[model samples]
Target: MMTDLVLIEQFDSRTAAEVARSILEANDIPVTFEADDAGEMIPHLAPVRLMVGSADEAEAREILSEAMKSTDEAGEEGVDGEPTA
Candidate 1:
């Protein structure tokens, strides 16, 4: 049977996409990634899409949002008295 997958976010880098996938998976939410070019032939043309089932979309989004918020807060901290741009 086919599952209804919902697009959560798109990433320019595979590492970022995989990290999101890992976060969702750790929470018991199934996730998958789709990309046009697997070999990174054209960096600008490639986009890694993170997808989750429609049923888990809300929870997955919440988890990612929290993670992003934390990341943003961490970035806001000044490094050596200089704030990160």
Candidate 2:
């Protein structure tokens, strides 16, 4: 059986998209990446897209949101190698 997929997000690089794919997969959510990089010759014209089944859209977003929030909090704690007050 095939499922309908919905676009969840787009990343400028394949590495970023792969990271997101790993996260979703770890949580039991299936994901696929789409890109049109023209064989790595026109990276600027290609954006990696993260997609998940329509039925999993909301749960996927929630998981991604929490993960991104945690990442943001960690990055915000220090600025240019200096601790923030």
Candidate 3:
């Protein structure tokens, strides 16, 4: 019975926002996905906002940032120390 009402972070791509939303939800934090339909109408418009609750806002952003960092690190790594192909 929790509600999502905090604007935690914004991303240019829906994919990234979705990934962030998933991370917050997985961590037991309530999340709401707000798609930028306006951006869809105009690709140059503002990015989409990934919001959560006020109480969990800070924690959610930290979780998302950490997740993003881990993803970046993983992408930088490769099997046998070889670059990704």
True lDDT of residue 52, candidate 3: 79
Best by TM-score: 2
Candidate 1's displacement at residue 28, Å, is: 0.9
lDDT rank order: 2, 1, 3
For model 2, the run of ten residues with the poorest summed lDDT: 76-85
lDDT of 1 by residue, 2-82 (tens): 199999999998888989999989999988888887477765577899999999999999999999998898788786757
TM-score of 2: 0.85
**Cα lDDT tens digits for candidate 2, 1-85:** 2199899999998888888899999999999988999866787788999999999999999999998998888887785766577
Q: When superposed on Cα atoms, how far off is each prediction in RMSD? A: 2.3, 2.6, 2.8
Off-target runs (Cα >4 Å) in candidate 2 are: 79-85
Clashing residue pairs in candidate 2 are none
Arranged by TM-score, best first: 2, 1, 3
- Lowest summed-lDDT stretch of 10 residues in model 3? 36-45
The estimated TM-scores of all candidates read 0.84, 0.85, 0.74
Q: Candidate 3, residues 1-84: lDDT per residue as tens digits?
A: 447487878888777777777788899988876775675776446677877778888888788779889888888869676778
TM-score of 1: 0.84
lDDT of 2 at 11: 93
- Backbone clash pairs for candidate 3 read none
Which of the two candidates, 1 or 3, achieves a greater TM-score against the reference?
A: 1
